[model samples]
Structures are given as C-alpha cells and as structure tokens.
Target chain A: MPYLPTAQSFLEQSRLLISARPTTTRITTKYTLPKTSPPDPSKSKSPPPPSSEPSQPHQPQPPKATLTLKTYDPISGTCLKYETDKAAEVGRLIAALGSCGRVMAALPAKEEAVDEGAMEVDAPVKEDAEGKAKAVPKEKELKGGQGQGQHKGGEKGGGGGGGGKKKKGKK
Target chain B: MATGHLSTDEFLIRLATLFESRRSVNHGSVFLTQKRLSPHDLPKAATDTPLPPSSPFPDLHPPHPLPILIRATNGKSKDKRKDKIKLSTVIQADELEGFFMRYADVCKAGMSGLKKRDRSGRKAKGKAKKKKGASGGGVEGEKKG
Candidate 1:
C-alpha cells in the first residue's frame, strides 16, 4: 500500500509540477523608430533668424578646420601651419604636445585657465585698439562649448614631462 | 538619427577617453540623442560654421568631432542636385562635456611638453614619444577607440 501511495497524493504532486512551469515574460518597448528621420519637435515654434548657410539638398559635409596651429621660425621667415579639424582635438593636441609654443590662441577657448596663448597676443591685441583679440576666444569657440563647468586644476602640471631619452644611434 | 556626424571611430575614441577617466557611470548616463536643435541654433561664427564649397581638405592631424546638429542638407543628389537630409549625429552635449573634462588635463599636459621639443630637434622626437605617453611604462595605451 505504501509503495503504490494514494491517488489523491499523486494528483497533488502532478498539480504542483504543472504549477511550477516557467512563464515567459515579454518586455514592452515604447520607442518606435519611424520610417524616416524624426521631425524636430521644436520646428513648429518660431525662433530667431536661421543661418544663411546653403540648404541645397545633399549629404551633410564633414566639418572643416577651424583652428590653425602655425609655428613660426624665429631665425628664418617661414612658418609651418597645422590646421586641426576639431577644436577639441587641437586642444587635446596642444595638451599632449605641451607648451602651445607660440600658438597660444590654439588653446581650447572659453576655459578660465590662464591662457598663455592669449597673453602672448596681448601686445598685438592692445595695438589693435579695437580690442578684437579679447573677443578671439569667444569667436573661435562659436560652436557653443561652455568653458564654465569644473575647473581641472593644473592640467598637465603646466609643462611637458622632462625630455624624452634620446636613443643613442650607433655610427 | 544617422546624420553620420560623429563616425563610429570618433565615438569609440570618446568612449576610450571616458573610460580612461574611470568615470564609466557618468559616461553611461549620456543619452545618445538630444532634442533636435533648431537650424537657427547652429553656431554662427565663421570658424564655428565654416561651411564651404567643398569639404575635402587634407589635414595633418586626425579629424576630430564637431558639434552635431540636426542640419538640413541642401545637396543630397549624386546627379549634382542639392537636398538637405535630416539626420542626427550620435553626440550628446553632456557626453562631449564629460569627454572634454576628462581629457582637459591630459591635453594640457601634452601641450606643456611641446616647450621642451622646441629646444632640440633630436630631443623633440623623444618629447613627442613622451607626449604620446606610456613609453615610460613600456606600454603606451593606443590613442584609439
């Protein structure tokens, strides 16, 4: 009798197994991508005058170089110009290279840091009389990177680490 | 949107930079898209918005990112026609801010080193290596995404 067990007990065991079945849950997503680009939500609202930039239908072109890093030869009358495509990269490049050399205007503008680049142009700016150089930073950073956030102190300790160890070439 | 403003490579670079900062949490919080900017809100400065006849300038340094906008294309025709395609670049303002903040110090350090390079041509090469960094550690983290 014990080996066979009761029919009621068997039914209860069967019910427990059936109830233990794993359930599949489906995740619901709200965002549905449209067939085409989503319309600008702010289009209906009127705003200031739009840029006169040519809007002839075409692929959006890659951005152009805004900052020009020009290195002037002190002895010679020649200069090497480096036109960086990104203002941010130029900033990073200058930071990586250390000492904007003579091209302090190349510093990422809008930062509160003491810009030696702007300082070097101080005389010329003063001479301009129009005080144009003072506006140079803002003019350069027209892409709206607000330099006001957190102040990273002493970025790079104000100097490139000591000179690289020159590899002694064998004759 | 596929404005194709910041390419995958560029995004990866930013991602690498943000990770290097050890601020991954902040990085994840960035939304890939922003409420579409008005065409008029586009930057107005010449340097800021130097749209030209063509954009095939060969530059010395690698091309970095620009402030992405939901711009209208005027010449979307291979047959020499113009039509602005409305697409959004995968760049968010906060992400850009975070990237700049993370690399700001690193970039400054790089700039600081250029002074030494100006002194000696041979040493300049070494300084360049140093600026590239990880040379001292025997392994410089590749400056890529």
Candidate 2:
C-alpha cells in the first residue's frame, strides 16, 4: 500500500522523473537510431545500364589439304595426282596391265628417264632409240595412218571403175 | 456274400463269355490279344539254335598311312622337308625379300614420323622456354644485379 498518484499527478511525476535523470540524455542519444527510409521503389522499373563496350567479331578459318595416293604412270611419264576417291581407278588401271610384273619393269625405266633431265611435269614421253622425244599419236591419227595409201587408192579405183562401167552402160 | 460255387457247365459258359468280350474289345490292338498255345502243341525236335558265328574278328588290320606317317617314315626333319620341297612355289625369293625390305622401310617411316612428332614437340617446348625467358627479361635482370 504505497501512495497511488492521480492521473494528472502521474503525468507531472513522469515529467519530473524524465527531466531529473541527466544520464538518460546520453542513453537516449546513443540508443535512439536514425530511421531507415524505405528502399527507393522507383529503381525497379528502370532498365539496367548497357555494357560499356561491344564484343569482338569471330573470324573464319581456312580448310586444310590432306595428301592421298601417289602414282607414276610409266607410259605417260606423268606424275598423276590421284586423290583418295580415285584409288580404285588406279588399281583397275594397274590390273589392266595384265600383271604387276610389267608395271614394275616399266616404273624403273620411267624413273630413269626422269633422272635424265626429263621434266617432271606432264606424263613422261617415251624417247626413241635416237634419244629424240616421241609424241603420243591420237586415236584418229592412228586410224588415219593405219588406213593410209592403200585405203585411198582402193576407194578411188573402185569409184572410178564403177563410174566407167556406168558410162559404158549408158552409151 | 453267399458261398458262390459255379457248376462246371456254368463255369465253362462264363469262360466263353469272358473270351468273347476280350476279343470284341481288342479289335484293333494285336498286342492286347491273348495267344493260345498248349504245351503238347510245341515243336517236336528242338532245331539247333545256330550260335551267331562271330565275324573273323577283323584280322588285326594295319594302321592307315597318313601324311605325317609318311613324313615320319621318310626320316626327314620338318625344316628340311619344308626347304627341300618345291610345290607350286609361285612367289620368288627376290620379290618376297624386296617386299619384306619395303615393309621394313614403311615401318621405319612410321617410327620416324612418330620420332619427328616427338622432336617437334620438344622443339616447341624449347621455343616456349626461350620465349618465356625473353619475356621475363626484366625479372632476370632484377635478380642478376
């Protein structure tokens, strides 16, 4: 049973108690934190700033060459370039020479020719006994040479004989 | 049950009926038919049951000659036989020797290619070390003096 103050007296006593404590001023200043303002809601709607610089463009690399088959045809003396796909064709040509034995014999001769200052460019042209370069005759040239003097004479004689007989018959 | 004794006549009639039923039931099955053979009706003189004459138990035949047997009997060693005989030996020694030499060359080429790759790798490493030394010249200079 201590004295209970009236509401008006309680208010006056609270004011007196608060003012009388000088230590409370430092405590209030220390504990009373500054209010944290709400995060700026306006920032959310704005787009992020673009990167300062552009990226580098990509450069394309060139394709590389791969080596395949190497062949030397003695007849042509040509160092022909046969890719991987043409290997079968090369095999077929080799087989067509009856046996590999003949091809082996011819290859050394061509190699020797190449060694003797023959240009290693196109197919090696075979040289005659006189050491002169021999040319490869075309198919038409071969046929013409084969038919030569005899064929033309025979045709002329046959035609002339037939015409003479026709003229005689008409007369 | 009463004492059941059939008279001889009744017994004979029952036996006949039993046989008749047995015959009717065994129509298609010969294995089921009962054979009637009296002891008195057996064959008179017992025929000689010929003992199956054994085959002249295959007169100890000589062993068949084999290729290996011929080779053995001929007294030639395997290596000598292989060297001595010339069966359709299509391939010549010169050609085969040449092929073997070429194959050895090819193997050498492959080994050389690998060695070249290793040497090139070492060269690259050496170049990289040289480049690093050149690039770190300032550090080397700082350490030296």
Tens digit per residue, CA lDDT, model 1, A36-117: 2323658737553455324543224321213333323232333333332333443433332221211111112233234423
Candidate 1 wrongly placed segments (more than 4 Å): A1-111, A116-171, B1-98, B101-145
What TM-scores does chain A show, candidate by candidate in order?
A: 0.22, 0.19
| CAPRI verdict (incorrect, acceptable, medium, high) for model 1 | incorrect
lDDT of 1 at B143: 40
Q: Give the Å shift of residue A8 in candidate 2.
A: 99
Model 2 per-residue lDDT tens digits across residues B13-50: 44334324323432110010001111122244522343
RMSD of 2: 52.8
Model 2, DockQ value? 0.00
